[model samples]
Each structure stands twice: as structure tokens, then as C-alpha cells.
Target: MTTRARPAIAAMAYHQGAFVPFAEAGLPLTTQALQYGTGVFEGIRAHTCADGGKLVLFRVRDHYERFLRSCRLLRIETGHTVDELVEITCELLRRNGTTADTYLRPLGYKLALLPGTRPGVGLSGVSDALSITGFPMGAYTPPGGIRCTVSSWVRPRSAAIPIHAKVTGGYVNNALAADEARAAGYDDAILLDDRGRVCEASTANVFAARSGRLLTPPATADLLPGITRDTVLALAADLGIETAEHELDVSDLRCADEVFLTGTGIGITPVNEVSGHPIGAGEPGPIARSLAHHYARTIRGGGDVRHHHWLTSVRIDQG
Candidate 1:
């Protein structure tokens, strides 16, 4: 019954085109992004390296690439390249004096004040805005593990709305599903697609292990296609564990040897139960634990050399 943790706000944040005091980083109430949820954002994690006390941003380029794609899908112009966004984010962290594990949120949004919901229509004066902010962050999921229930809410299909984009409006559906789960005393909820197949958790990609192999719902299942999920699959393959992408059912989760969720925010969180049914031994399974350990090591600039390519160092000389 524990709630998710959020870091305290930092003193400085990058807003529009300049760094400003966090209190001054405000948008107009009538902005189109606020009015109609026409915004795209990415959540990236930065970690402190034990060696040389360096700070490292994980997968900055990949996140920005996805961010740009999301902006394009929403017709919001970022006006910045992936490299520029990375540099902006790095500068934001540097100016904020970040020294510990932190989370970076970069957002692109339409800033017009028009009232109608017609996207890309009747907007002659609208402009796009971008912002990057960061703060200390910790585990997004509860420790030990979490219990999840299947949400009554179904994921929106791609035809109805581009399901691949991390559009702001779409997350209201996630908030509803998560609120329902929390109200019911569960840690989180698993969403299903229109076809009644397992899609993902409220904010993370879902994975289940059976017969020592890992399986997750395909991208077509309306999941976010998380970077952490990709990292886990790679780590699993390196560990000699097989992985596959396919459709899943709640029964598949209940009967699996292990169940877990992955994301930049949550890392690898074991699911001990689903819909009141205990999964396997009702605890974190061996495969999930191994993947979590490997992920932690890799993110902190440890583990395999190949994994090091994913990190972007933020340690700059202050002199």
C-alpha cells in the first residue's frame, strides 16, 4: 500500500530557451499543451559513478530520439536536434549542481491559447516550447515487490490515437488505471488491449519468465516500448536466457515462474502477485533478480563494456 516517491523540485530549470529559477518556469494557463494535452516528454535517469565521483546520464541520445518522434507525431516542433537536446539536458544538470541519482524530464509542447480540440487546425499563431528539468529520484516502485491487479480500463488502439507516442493526453488513461489500482489497495494495475491481451503495467513494460525464458508483450500491444525493457532483454540474452515478444494474458502472468515490470523510472520491479493470486513463490524470482542486478551494475557504469556505450558522462571540470 505504499505510494510512489517523487524527488523534491530543484532550484533551477531550463524553460523555453533559457535557464530560469524553478518558480519562474511557468506556462500560461491557456497554453494549447495545457488545454488539450498536446505535449511529448521523456524520463531519463542520471546516476553517480563510484569511480572519480562522476555523474552520468543514461541513454540521453536514445531518449531524445524517441522524444523527437513523439513531437513529430503530435505535430509539435521541438526546433532542436537530438544532440542539442542532450546538451541542453546536460547543461541543466550542471547548472542545478546535481551530484546524486537524478531524473531528467524533457518536454516539447504546443503553446497556443486556442480553445478548440482540433489538433493542427485553425492554429496560425501557435508556437512550440521545450523545457528540461531534473531532480533527485529514487525507486518508483515499492521495495520487496508489488502486487498488481488487471485494470478494467483498456489501452487505446493505434487507430484511435497514435499509441506509440508518449503524448500527454494519453497518460490520463494511465492515471485512471493506476488510481483504480491504488484505491483497491494494490500497488499498480496491468492494462489490457482492446483484444483483451496483456499490454503493460500502468507506466512500465511488463515481462514474465517461464521455463527460464523471458516473454513480454509486443510493441503492437500498445506498450511504451521502454528503454529499460530493451536493456533487460539484452542483459537476459547475455546471461544465456532466451527472450521473446508476443501476446500475453493475465493467466500467463499468474502461472509464470516470475513476473516483473521495467522502465527508466522503476528499474526492474518483481511482481509478487496479480489479482490476488501469488506468482510462483510469491517473491522476486531468480531471473528477475539477476536482471535487476545486471541492470543496476550497467547503469552505474559497471558490468559489461558494451553497456558503457549507453552512458553519457556529465562530469565537467569546474575550474
Candidate 2:
């Protein structure tokens, strides 16, 4: 959690544009997404690939595909197809390669929405805005397991807002919980549903393993249907590990043999404790390490072949 602060961003790519300095990756203040969180986005990881540092994006196709789905759901007119988004993302990374751990974000926002006569931002226009930014980031480390505290803030009820969408505004919930956790002297926070069922970490999707079986919250449980979460589940299935998608409460975490969180930035990381209780002796369990290793291989190109559909190669010859 410590480093020499670097420039915020070196370069960025807006729709149909590339190699624009970060400063130029701006929009009018009246842009719909800027006025109201009306767009969706996806977080992708481009790891150092092959012997030549090719920077292959793990599951780039799937990420862009979901981004397309999100745009459709939001009624945004995305001018490009999924394949075009993939091409642009790869090109952006090739141009702005960073030395440290990095993350890629592509935001699809409503560019033309206007404020209604009531003085409130509304979905008056349907055109979308997409921008790609690649930056360096890392997470707080735990020597044995990440220690987390329950958050005082509850997740937004799905009936109020579609909690599943990766809208930038939805992260206000995460920000509030994370701030509470940090002030509570913890590395992260675990949020509960309106009904008090355990949801997920502030930003990362969560999973638990016990008695050789894995369990995680269902998509309907007010959690994002996370791409990395799905990939981890599939990897476990390939290894003959049984996984169950169900709603779990705090008691499950306190008694689980292991707990791990996954996301685009860090892949899979072990969480050894929750609310100050040790999870299976406070060390990363076999399931956690196994999934982590397999995930690393699959992302870095050495996992089971039957599941390679989730991966997208970066060897695209743009000539």
C-alpha cells in the first residue's frame, strides 16, 4: 500500500481515437455520464505474455462481450462492435505499457443524455461514450490472510438500482463501505444485503471453500455477476471441484475452511479472517492456492485446454 506516487495517467483512448495524452481524454461537462452515472464499464487485465512481453489480455473477448451486453441493457448506442472494442483495447495497451501491475478500464457512458425540465439528469439521449485508461495499481497485502471487518453500510437494494450493472455511480456504495472499513482499522470491508445476508467484498467478488465444496453468493443476491468470479468457478470445475451458487451469511465465513476474493486487478487473493475470526488456521488453504495457481496459468497460458474459450489471444496483427 506504499509507493512513490507517479503521474495519474500517461495516455488514454477514447472511442475511435488512440494515443491521446491523458489530459485530452476529456469531455464536455454536460456529457450524460459525467452528469449522471449512466454508463457501464469493464475492468481487464493485460499481463506480460510470452518471451517478448507481448502483454496479452486474459479473457479480453469475454470482457468486451459483457461490456456490449451492459450497453444494450442501458440503452446506449455503442457505435462499435465487441471485436472493435477488443482491437482498440489491445492497441491501447501496446502503446501505454507500464512496468508495474496494471489495470485496464473501458467506460461506456451515455454521451448525449440531457437534464430534464425538472433539473435532474435523465436518459433523454441514448448515445454512448467509451474511454479506455490503463494504469498501475496493487492491493493491500496480508501476511497470512487478509483481515476484513463487516461494513456498517449495506448494499443498495436491487429494486432501487440494478446492483449488477458496472456503472461508475454504483461504486458510491463501495466507496462508503471502504472508507468505513479503513477508519475501522481494517484492510477491507464485507457488505451485507438489505436482508442482512453476506454479499461480497467492497469491490471484489467472494467465494468460500469447505469440506471440498465451494460456495458463493448467487447473482440474484445483489452482487455483480463478476467475470473473474465466473472464470474461477469454471477453473475449479475443470479440476473436479464442486461449486455451489447460493446465498451465504456471516456464519458461513466464520466457519469456512478458506475464503478468497477475485477481481481483474489481483486475480485471486486469500482472505484468512473475517470480523476477527480465524479461517482454518489463518493461512491460505489448498483450494485458495490451487485456484490461484490454476488461474495464473490460465491467464498466463498454461491451463486446461477444454476451457480456453474464456481466453483471448493478443497476437492480433493490426496491419
Candidate 3:
């Protein structure tokens, strides 16, 4: 896929109940979510179609479904249904007139304590707010591949937090893990569960290809069930590639033919090295390359008709 230059952030955003200038979309200092990290969010992408005629959002409904699920976990009410959120996202894209690859972040969070409510970090007494902002972004991962470190931070299990949900507060674990990896000169981090098994990467799902079959941890392994990871599994089935969901250890990845990470932001990126050792040939492997090619096309209305259903088209508002 051809990469585009990172464009300036859009000047508009969906704030509260209406679209507004980006500068006007700020939350107050007393916002409960800001103080307590009581928020949920989804990172969605919009791509210019192969013909460059218009922009299409990949799995927009699925993202919102997951977004709502996270909000429900946090007791945050978005006041918008899945379909309504989809339309609002399309309208936001149209208003921005974005013509390149873009990333959208929809955030639902606790606003403040409701009137007559006592001051506390309790979710029951807080008001809720939702906002979405978008900006241009291309493939953020290195095209060649990336090196990762087995992080010292252990991933929190569902017992400690809702590991399946994209809770804003839970990301502190991811941030610290990623920072440790970067400080060690690695591109990312692979986190292990309390049981000392591979759970996922800092912010993405981890996969290892062995004997032409793909293996990844089950959702019970204390990782967010990623939409992109689901897409890859479906696409692999279409390609007649076998897959299994099971626990994997560091030794498993070290011995596998290839290791890769999948997510909405980074797409599919190969892990060339881990903890100072090369994974396989220490480069992007054939399976990852093939899947990445197909993923790029599938997001842009390519492949089968069924795949096109995952895309939501929006015409640019040139006026």
C-alpha cells in the first residue's frame, strides 16, 4: 500500500451533542473522567477508496458496538445508538473533507458528578459525555517490520480489571509496557498474563504462524478481543489457512515461523525480533505480507462482496 504524508489534524470535532470547532471541544479541569480515567474509546480508520472517489470507514458499526460495550462497562451513557453514531461519523468525515487515510477516536467518559450528588469517583453519580475527533495518519509501523521486547509489566487479568473492554484507565498498563520497550530500543512490547503466558502486545493482538497455521491467545487470556484480530481470523479462513486459539509462551513465539501484531492503528505488523533475538528470518514473513496486502484491499472495497459490507462510504463535502 502507498503511504501518504501525515496531514494536519482536522479543524472540526463532534463535541457533546453537536459538531464544533476542534479548539472548542475541550473538557473542563474538573471532568471526572480526566481525573479518574473513567473513559472508553475506539480507534477507527477511514480510507480513500482504490479509485480515490470517496472515503470509506472500515467496520464502523463493529467499532461502535465495541465502543458501546466498553461504555456500558463503565456506566457511561453515550445517548446515541449504533446507527446514529455511524451516521454522525460519516457526517464528521464529510465536513472535514479528508481525502487521505485518517484515524478517528470516539471517546465516552464520565463528565462530572450529577447535580445533588456527592463528590466521589463513583460511576453511578457522574454525568456522561461523548466526543469524536479525526486526523490524517498513514501506516505508523515500519514497513520492513519491528523489533519487540518481552515487557517486565504483566498484563492485568479480568479479576483485577475488565480486560476485555477498552477502558481508558486500563491503558496505563499498556503505556508503561510500551515505554519500557522503547527505552530498551525495541519497537513495542509483548505483555504476559499473570500466568506467565503471552497475552498480547502493548495495544494490539499477538499472533504466531506455525506450519502455515496461525495461533493466537484466546479471549480468556486477558486481552481485548480486537476487531482487527477477528478480521484476520475471518480472512485466514477464507484463504484456507488453519487457525487455533490457545495460550502461547515466549518459547512458542521464539520457535514459531513468524510473529506479528494486529490492531486498528498499526494494521498488521511483523515482529522481526523479540528480546534481542531474531524471530525466524528476522524479517517480514510470507504469511504476514500476504495478509497485509489482502487487508489493505479488503478495507478499500476490494475482495469479495461480503467484505465490502464492512465498509461505509461517505462522499466528501467540497462546498
Candidate 4:
């Protein structure tokens, strides 16, 4: 007997207040979020659990907390509590029937239809909106390791903009640096702050290891306080590794024993070379490999009881 193939799950999204076909989702061209980049967003990952046919969202509560902080910074009144948003995201994933590694994006934005209003200059009559979308995603960095260069562009000062907030407008600065890096024949870029101190990579936070201890830029370095960065720190402590948060210099990376980038999208990716200098044996270092392995296991719900709280399972049966 022959069996018929099941139909694919239709791409779906949660916008405003309801689910809609992905292709049918739309917003006004004059939206303040669109015209002036007045929005904040987060990138979250979900992994298939080892013991069941369920997807586990990594650090959902932490992501939502950060999202709300971004909204408060941007004055976008999403009005939904963290629990409500988590429920919406879980329902969206259930509808999509995603079973592989997936990326979920939740955005809170100014929804006003002001054509030419600049960001932070408009009157108090605008509206706010939120949307959640998910899709299959894979490794954002190349296998093995990546090459990086120090970009000519500098990160925006915290005084000029709340650099910790994931505001859409702020990413233009990241884009410029990334583009410059790619054009100059590098896989990624490392940005510096106004004072020439190391800030972070184009899209992720930076970490360097020397003599077995881990070092990352301080919160005052004008970069996103990445959730993944926090996860790495926690995992490192559990593994009996020491960590330090302080100002870093470009020369520090050039002389470091190892380097890696961490974020929701990239996870923990090693840097083999920086600005033409080879890092520790010119490969993924031992410390990075250990942390990456632990991180992978924790995210996939693989016998790590300590991190069980980090996963939010999305199974139709549970609902």
C-alpha cells in the first residue's frame, strides 16, 4: 500500500491582534515604524526537544523582558504582558508546525501613519503595535570559524541613542560597518566606541579568552546587552570558568589567546583571525568549543536540569 504525503504547514504570522497568512501580512507604507525606523525587536531561537516531538523556546521570558524594556525606551506601548506575548508566540509556532531549528522575531513599533514625521519629534497622538513571526533558520556563521576586521565606522554613543535598546534605527550603524567589512574581504566586522575602545561585533557581543579566563566588554561599551551573552556567562560559571567584564582594546583582541562572537542568531562562533592576525592556533579554541557544546545541549533540552527553566515547550498536547 502506498501512502500519501502530508501537505506542508502554511506560513503563518501573528500581527496586531490575529493570525494571518505570511504573504498577506501588511502595514501602511506611512507607518512611523516603517518611515523612521521607530521600532524595537528581538531574535529568539527554538530547538526541537530530544525526548519529545516538541519545540523548546530558549529564554522566552528573558527575551520578552528585554523587549518590554526596549518598548519603554522607545515609548511604544505594546500593552501586552510578558505572559500574554509568550502565549501568542507559542500559538504562532504551533500554527506553523515548525520542527527544526527556528528563529522567532517579535517587534514592538510605533504604528502611526505619519508620512514625514521624524523619530522623537512627533506629537503625542501616535499608536503602538506588536507582531510575532517565525521561520526555519540555520547557522548564521560559516562552519569552522570566521575572519573579521576592525571597521572604520564607530558605534553610536549611548548618549546619542540608547545603545542597549534594540531599536531598528540603530542598526543602520551596524549595516554600514558590516558592509564595509564584507567589501574589504572579511566575513564580519568589529566596531569600536567613540573613545577607540572595543564595543562589539557588527551584530553580536564579543568575547575573548586568555589563559583560560573569559573577557567581554562592559555594559558601558555602547553595545546591546545580548541575552546569549548572559547565557554564556552563566554556562561558563557552571563549568568552573572565570569571567570578567571590562573595557577592551583592539590590541587586546589582536593579542588574545582566543575570540568568539555571541548572540541569539550566531550563538557562539569562533574567530580564527582578526585584522589579518591569527588567533590561538588559528582555529576554534578549546574554551569556545566547551561553552558551545554546553550551550547546544542546554538549548536542546539534553539532560541539563540546571537550564530546564530556560526552555518553554510548545506542544499542542500541553495546551
Write down the lDDT of every candidate, Cα atoms only.
0.87, 0.76, 0.91, 0.87
The Cα error of candidate 2 at residue 303, in Å, is 1.7
Q: Give the winner by lDDT.
A: 3
| Backbone-clash count (model 1) | 0
Which pairs clash (backbone N, Cα, C closer than 3 Å) in model 2?
A: none
Model 1 pairs in collision: none
lDDT of 4 by residue, 1-319 (tens): 1122343333998889899998887898867788888899999888888776899999999999999999988888887999999999999888887677788999988887445554564524578888888878767676588999998999989999789999999999999998888888888899998889999999999999999989999976799979999999999999999999978898999888999999998899999999999998999999999999999888889846988999999884434
Better of 2 and 3 by TM-score: 3
On residues 15-122, what C-alpha lDDT tens digit does candidate 1 reach at each position? Answer: 989999998999878687788777889999998874756688888899999999998887778789999999888888888776778898988998974444455543
| Residue runs of model 2 more than 4 Å from their true location after superposition | 1-8, 15-18, 97-101, 112-119, 137-143, 315-319
Candidate 2: C-alpha lDDT: 0.76
RMSD of each: 2.3, 3.1, 2.2, 5.5
Ranking by TM-score: 3, 1, 4, 2
TM-score of every candidate: 0.95, 0.89, 0.97, 0.93
Off by over 4 Å in 3: 1-7
**So what's the TM-score on candidate 3?**
0.97
User: How displaced is residue 272 in candidate 3, in Å?
Assistant: 0.2
